[model samples]
Target: MEYRSEISEELEAWERKITRKSSMVSRSAKRIQNRINGVIPERLHSIVTNSIKTMVQGVLVGSTYTVHPPKKNRSLQVRDQQAKELIRKYKRIAATEGAGTGAGGILLGLADFPLLLSIKMKLLFDLASTYGYDAKKIEERVFILTIFQLAFSSDDTRRKSYRKISSWDESLSQIEVRKKYEEHDWKTFQLEYRDYIDLPKLLQMVPGVGAIVGAYVNYHFLDWLGENAINAYRTRMIKEENQTT
Candidate 1:
């Protein structure tokens, strides 16, 4: 019980961090990306965004059969510890892939976009299983995307995504969340995600800097993503546990 209290306190702190205003660095980066985006043609933007939107939707559909052994009885600490190990393994894999692709220049740097997205999606599915949630449901799969957006979108979008996450498992959220999921914006999901990563990933195409940028960005991004997933799942578990007791 004491441990749970500590976890809850930690979560409150993390929540504050996520909801805070964007830093100067983040704002600067967003501005730079906006300028870069402006010079780029609208057609090009549409193509890339549509491509990613389709790819992600495909991944969601493909993982529809994902089933876990249903460790619903598992303790949160045990589940989270096991999840951390998996996250470490995934982080290494992403870093290595990023380095290899980044070394290969523009072509491979472009390849990393789709490849990394797939890896990120797979990790989300693994995490849902780890947290004893089934990703097989359409609603849950959409929630996985919400987790992704929470980690990588603009400040406004992140706050919105966090609300959906915070609302998880609460009586008021179920029907509302279902309606929201039906109205989920795949285009915004792709655009915000792309804009967020474009700076480091674009640097990853440079001859001298590509490999290092790729390795560092992919490694840390996955780590950030892992923490976000853990906390999101923890919110639900903590709330449910409280109600039961």
Candidate 2:
């Protein structure tokens, strides 16, 4: 009977160890998953900005070639070549400077993505005002974008922003905000700004603007999610304690 009891105790101890190991493995897996999910929004942001920039370039080049033909004079040809070279030089500068579309993407990867976002948003607002977009409209758009970001953030870290925004006692639901912004007419949206800042112009304001916005938003959101998750786990613990009592 003693030998049988010793065997049972050994089995129970092994089961406990296995349970602990399994729990550790599960936690580790979740941490890794969270890290992986955190980076996705940043990548998406870069892609969206890049696509917009490419479209703008196509429109600009097509309009230049189709709407205004260069003069046929030899002197004009020489001037045209020089102008082309200058454009190339400027393009290179834009690519490297914070004023380029790629700059936004690059900024997203940096450690200071949030700072970059604030700076870029300010710059864009100024540019919009200069172009003639109404100040109120510009502010509204910015707020809309911020809210859209909070709602659509795929990064586990930025879930905090989602919670904060969601918890607000406002008349606008998250879905409503997203729909309102999305349904806004593109022409009206652009016209609302005082300045006629095209995609390239807007992007050039912040180096790697796409990436910077993505990363910062993602990181912030994920942090919120992490906190909420912890709270949820603690609640479960409390519930278990109450049951025991």
lDDT of each: 0.82, 0.35
Measured against the true structure, the TM-scores of the candidates, in listed sequence, are: 0.89, 0.21
Flag regions of model 2 displaced more than 4 Å.
Answer: 1-111, 136-152, 155-245
Best by lDDT: 1
lDDT measured at residue 60 in model 2 versus the true structure, 0 to 100: 25
- Per-residue lDDT of model 2, residues 211-233, tens digit only: 34333333443333222322222
Error of 1 at 134 (Å): 1.1
Model 1 regions lying over 4 Å from their true place: 42-44, 63-67, 170-185
- Backbone clashes in each candidate structure, one number apiece? 0, 35
RMSD of each: 2.5, 24.5
User: What lDDT does candidate 2 reach at residue 59?
Assistant: 28
